[model samples]
Target chain A: MHAVRNIRLCTKDCLCLYVCPTGATDTETGQIDASKCLSGCRACVDACPSHAISLIPAEFPPQQEKTVSVKNALLTLAASKMDQEEIASKLAETTGNPVLRQLAEALGKSNRLMAEDMLRESGYMLPQSRTVGELLESLLSEKQPADFPEAAVKRLLELVNGNTMQEGKASAFEKIDY
Target chain B: MMRKFVCGICGFVYDESLGYPEGGIAPGLKWEDLPEDWICPLCGATKVEFKEQETVIPEEKKQSSLDEEHQEKIRELSFKELSALCSNLSKGCEKQYRNEEADLFRQLAEYYDSKSSAAFEAQISDLAALIEADLSSGYENANRRAAAVSDRGALRALTWGEKVTRILSSLLSRYEKQGETLLANTNVYVCEICGFVYIGDEAPEICPVCKVPNLKIAQIQRG
Candidate 1:
């Protein structure tokens, strides 16, 4: 495992800089030098005040399996959440009252949140899960709504099937290897 | 000619025009006409339980919907409530991967906690019970009021909130059954767009729900 900084949470406490024995933490770039960071050493993890830094395993465990019943239940919940989100967005767009519009926006955002949770629980949101590819394929086959995020999904499918690691930023294991 | 009298103990209003049908009392029966043996159906209080109630006009029902006693109950914000609100805001920020904002909110929560003057520390389960009650009836009341005034935005928010809460409640029950096993070995990733949580070695190329790009997704580093 190696420590990574969530830049958003790093409040510039600079405790990580002082505590890192290898001087791996760079405040300028806000990226930890994985090569210099000792695996399993959590000095900065404990010292940081904002708790923005955490350990990520060099190798991730495989995806967990779900039952058929759980999958069905999740899909049903997702469908309803989607419908609610759409309705909320429409209401927000048409409403003239500022408070009402904000309320509608919050509702739409919350519905999306719940729907995502359901999808994650059902094994559709994980890149390593085989169900992801299958779901993408099915979505491609179906007649989706005009606003459906087809292009993004297609790009994601390509990335998932090809290089799981992102460019410019290598996996933690790869960075530590060098 | 009929008036309503509420049970002080249970908030069960006894309307003379619509007498407790299920309780075997017929419509148009005056409170004085009913036998003294008739008790509060909800709390089994005696007829004397009606002493605190006044003659409530039907049309002005909305004005008295939240009585003085209830208003007083919510008048002051307890330390626990503030802490809970800050904690909730922190969690919301965490979901959006706004780690800095989340940390700030968490600090606020801790500040509230340090200043908490309650005789006892609040239990999370007790908070859960309050949330359950709110999900069950609070949104419904708000929706009814919004519908009355034809407020489309408020109505939409209430409708979505109620439906999502119900769905989440069911999902939570299922999670309670085997959440540990379900989350045994996988890493959890959350999409910044729709707040979709992904469990894997890494985030999905795209959020299945919101279809946001990989750059927008981030792993949850629990604090």
Candidate 2:
């Protein structure tokens, strides 16, 4: 854990500068230096008069997974927001009234933000995390349609194995439908 | 006599079944009976800016069995097919000047491919090789498409997407180090509107991230 300062609440008492053993709290940016600060040390956090400093863990716990139903609902709402954003964008472009156009611009931005938030919540925003990796693996082993892209899978495997340089040769996998 | 009106500016719905009690509007109030000067609580838009929208009652929400079947159809696609679909979708987004969304779709495509490789790491993975080629080609296409269009709104959205992706990536790294044992002990709740996660015994009265009421927070079960 490292102590971070909330500059808004920081009183500039400089108490943290005195308490911090590694001078991590004495940074010019008013933020904690995670690398310099010792692990689990909360000396500055305890000494801060304004309570602006708090210890944040280096590692965060895993986020819980949403059920399929909840995911579907969120995705549906995201699609609706995307539609609203597109309409607002068009209004902003074509509206004759300046005031109405400004309002439309604001609405377009707001709708986009809302849609992105929903997408983040739906797990698409996450990178290749371990949980997602496991889920993907499970999906791949299952039965697939006749037109499933087997060549794509083969190419992906070669890339992961660091054999991308030898991918020019066409293989029989591309000819197979199943 | 209950009617629904949606604010054109912010999509805030004014349903007479649940009137704006905070604004002193009583339940069962007709849309026409609303004070002509009344503005949308969300975006301050006047009544003239409100449009009548189709209201889905609670009972009608139950009649979405067809939607469920549609979802099942999507779920039926194999991982390889899904990755291909995601890659194609990313290319489509790139062409539309949605750089941020395009990046996200690309990340998802990479993720699905990574999973396949991880699952069959001992074997010669054909999927991994294909995804590698696609990744390089996809980036080249996205870069070319982004240079052709210059929309401020798209640029702003792209910035926001990058910020969100960075935060989520940090969280993922943290979780990887902490493991599931630590997470199992904490109670986790997800925001229904924004999907923000909160860890605690009780949900916050208001979501600090989105400012939504705690009524939307739903607890997830730990394995």
Q: Highest TM-score: give the candidate number.
A: 2
- Stretches of candidate 1 exceeding 4 Å from the true structure: A8-13, A97-99, A133-178, B1-223
Candidate 1 C-alpha lDDT tens digits along B1-223: 7878876433568899998899789998998998965756643345654642565444332432434323332122234333444454456446444456556556655665555433433232332343366465555454444444454434443444444354333323433555444345545454555444444556656654445577877665422
Angstrom error of the Cα, residue B215, model 2: value is: 24
Residues A35-146 of candidate 2 have per-residue lDDT tens digits of 8988877888789889988765432333334445444443444444444445555666666655434434544444445555544444433222233334445545868566
For model 2 the local lDDT of residue B219 reads: 67
Interface RMSD of each: 19.5, 20.3
Q: What CAPRI grade goes to candidate 1? A: incorrect
Look at candidate 2 and tell me the lDDT of residue B108: 66
The TM-score of candidate 2 is: 0.41
What are the runs in model 2 whose C-alpha is more than 4 Å off? A94-96, A124-178, B1-34, B40-223
First chain of candidate 1, TM-score: 0.66
